[model samples]
Target: MTDPFFLCTLLWFALSIAALARLRRRDRQAIQAQIRQVGQLADETNELILFLDYSAPGFKEIDAFLLTDMPGRVTVVFHAPQWLFAAKAKRWERHCVVSADCLNASSSGMTPTRVVLDKGGKYRVFYEVPAFLKLWSRSKM
Candidate 1:
């Protein structure tokens, strides 16, 4: 038990465990902050922010929307819906992947911009439809 090799290995293991615990705590706090931001945005907008799968093949929709927007068009950024306050944020973080068809863009007469949060809650992507094409693309979405 007094061997230097065993002592060194035990010390390394203890340090590694401490480092891992610190990293985990940091990650948890970051996730909480992200959730708070999302919740606040959702509350302010009072609109449903559509969540999409960033890893899918059809994720090009956000890119298309970005390209289609006119250079002069104004942009608006809004947050999540009321239901996402705090309790449901965890569920949302766990299960944000959803089909685009879940939303009916035409019912509102205007195509509302789409908001997507990354799975890690580290980034947000917004897809704004152009004013001219709002009606035109309303049926397409």
Candidate 2:
């Protein structure tokens, strides 16, 4: 009787571990999906800007300002829908310096920009900047 009970307990433990592993895999997949979505959005935004025949004023002489200056003073406007707020919040919580400036533009109507020093070079995670001027202008009105 005792042996049977022990076997049952061991089986339960194994099953529990399998379930936990599955959950962890699912969580990882979800995080990867979010990362990809963010990348795609950034790319689309860049394409749209380039399609507009506009350029990042002043930084023209420099090549790839986004990759170089991103770790320093850089601005990212969040346009992900409301449903993605939780994900954005998670990122903000993970990144963003304690004294980071969070500024919400009066025109954008969205939450303030979540600024942070890209210590881990993760800004590369985002490869595009949307129509900052247009968005700002529209938000102001």
Candidate 3:
């Protein structure tokens, strides 16, 4: 009775929404568990840590822009407060990066954080975006 194209589009739309929701839920749960283990209450005052995930093909084939996934690369970021940064240094939680080394790489979008994994200016700068929103918004001016 209905156009096949329309039905396919509808199904894709529903699937897309579900995927987004699922990603959000999974990300939130991971963050919450980390916060709990780190002994920090999830509050609005200050974010204890922020998680950002860069999904792509693979590291070797990852593009500088990170807009597409060709060979498959995923760089997950775990950002933490300055004071507590050292405490999490040894944990194999994720691709962890200090807040000092991260910045909002977008003019828009839900405050996605781009963390530089390299220690100093001497090495190649890797662009990695985090998945969660931090408590404080940077570059608001």
Collision pairs in model 1: 41-79, 41-80, 42-79, 42-80
Ranking according to lDDT, highest score first: 1, 3, 2
| Candidate 1 residue lDDT tens string, 38-84 | 45544432122343334433335433543453222221222234443
Top candidate on TM-score is: 1
Candidate 3 stretches greater than 4 Å from native: 40-141
**Across residues 1-141, which tens digit of lDDT does each residue of candidate 3 receive?**
999999999999999999999977665454344434432232221222333333322322222223332122223343445545554444333323333234333223333344322222222222333221121123211
**Candidate 3, residue 9: lDDT:** 100
Q: How much is 69 displaced in model 1, in angstroms?
A: 29
Clashes of 1: 4
Predicted candidate 2 versus true structure: per-residue lDDT over 31-122, tens digit per residue: 34433443354442221111111133322312233333222322233333444534543544422211111222122221222211233323
Candidate lDDT (C-alpha), each: 0.41, 0.35, 0.37
Residue 52 displacement (Å), model 3: 11
Question: Top model by lDDT, which number?
Answer: 1
lDDT (0-100) at residue 134 of candidate 2?
32
